[model samples]
Target: MDEIITRLQRIENLLEHLQAERVSKEFYSIAEVAQMVGRSEYTVREWCRHERVRGQKSRVGCGGTTEWRISHAELLRIQNEGPLPIAKRFG
Candidate 1:
């Protein structure tokens, strides 16, 4: 009986820990998105580069270089329905 109570307590603690990792930011970097999606940073960058995920380049890097940022809404959309369609070019 004591062992069962201990196991349940441990599971509850683990669940709380996992729940604490919720997304609380409006925008996230490529690295953050990569970890959330279980993919590499390179792959996330590609998704932004190809317009496959509705990402935007923000001026938030060193040396005045821009970096890709994904919104929380887009991340949810991706987790629910995969990538967005490729945007049409106007050239």
Candidate 2:
């Protein structure tokens, strides 16, 4: 029973490490965000153009396309806000 408990603890530690690594490595591209929120990439670009979505800019894609790296926190905010008032449609 003690050996089983020790193994379970080790597994728990491994799971925690994996979760941390996943969070650190996780990054969403513009297209990914658009798909996630059911918007168009063009709309997302427009929002970025108008400073709608607040996030840090990051380079993405093989050709180094510029993308706004919206963190999970910002996404939650946007979700709660229920879309930008003026902007009709999102990408």
What TM-score would each prediction reach against the true structure? 0.66, 0.54
Backbone clashes in model 2, listed as residue pairs: 39-91, 40-91
Q: Write the per-residue lDDT of candidate 2 for residues 1-91, one digit (tens) a residue.
A: 9999999999999999999886632455567778878899888766766668775788767998776776776666666784455545433
Candidate 1: tens digits of C-alpha lDDT, residues 1-91: 9999999999999999988996389998999989988899998888788888899988875788899999999998877888766668611
Model 1, position 28: C-alpha lDDT score: 89
- Once model 1 is optimally superposed onto the true structure by TM-score, how far is the C-alpha of residue 35 displaced, in angstroms? 0.5
In candidate 2, which residue ranges exceed 4 Å CA deviation?
A: 24-28, 55-72, 87-91
RMSD of each: 3.6, 4.7
- The candidate scoring highest on TM-score is 1
Q: Model 1, 17: alpha-carbon shift in Å?
A: 12
Worst 10 residues of 2 by lDDT: 82-91
